[model samples]
Target: MAIKFTPIPTTTAESWRNGGTDAHGQKPERRISDGRAPCRHCLKNVPEGDAVLLGAYKPFDAAGAFTETGPIFICEKPCKRFQGGTNEVPPVIAQRDQFLIRGYSADEKIDYRTGQIAKVSDLVSQAEKIFALEDVSFIHVRSAAYSCFTTRIDRAR
Candidate 1:
């Protein structure tokens, strides 16, 4: 029943850093972090006054109705990707009091029944319950307030 909390792939982040366009097909906006912005690649909050790349990111490979593109932040400079204990929530995500959790099927369709807003402490347990369902293939952790993409969670093999 192990679960892996994953950051955005480094290759993708590097692409963005190397002048790649966002989901909107436009250059990513560079901004100064307000400390609340978390880098999706590093799974850590970008400190206040530091540079960040704000852009639209589509987390799925498929292009369909179920596929969603949303705003995300990443460090303007390179940072180490997150490597942490399986089944533990990333600190950047846990820093928030609550988050939206949803499950997606193997075909990349949303499983409406698996969506909920969970307290940080309850996140792991809730994700476990979602993973219990046969239809659920992966989970997305999102900001409860802004509904921005935070990180992804996958059932460990």
Candidate 2:
């Protein structure tokens, strides 16, 4: 199976940049990047000294007990959304040490059996394995240390 690393939609990111409220109904907090945080839309590190928008984002469209809302960083300036071949891991995320990988069903509910803390080196293979499961419709990569949202993965067409 070919899996693609998917970033949040550009429209959603644009909304935030245009003074939209976050998931908690609050404005996105602007902060200076330390060069370690990746903008969820571009899947690249927000450069040091660049302004970042910190806010809560729910990666799913569904509202349910298993749906999670978590923190994410977005570049305050315009950035092209990440575009890569199927099964290619974004460079910024690939440089990370580890991340929490979990599969979600079609309904957007977490499938606990697919949860694991995976090394960056194993992300592609691990995601492929999870995609092999029948119930898994997608996967979400999150910071293992902070539990913040990173990126979403889906079986490529």
Task: Estimate TM-scores for all models.
Answer: 0.97, 0.97
* Cα lDDT tens digits for candidate 2, 21-110: 999999999999999879999999999999999999999998999888999999999999999898888977987899999999999988
**What C-alpha lDDT values do all the predictions have?**
0.92, 0.92
lDDT of 1 by residue, 1-157 (tens): 7899988999989999999999999999999999988999989999999999999999999899988899999999999999878887787977889999999999999999999999999988999999999999999998998889899999876
What would you estimate as the lDDT of candidate 1?
Answer: 0.92
Clashing pairs in 1: none
Q: For candidate 2, which ten residues in a row score worst on lDDT? A: 86-95
* Clash pairs (backbone) in predicted model 2: none
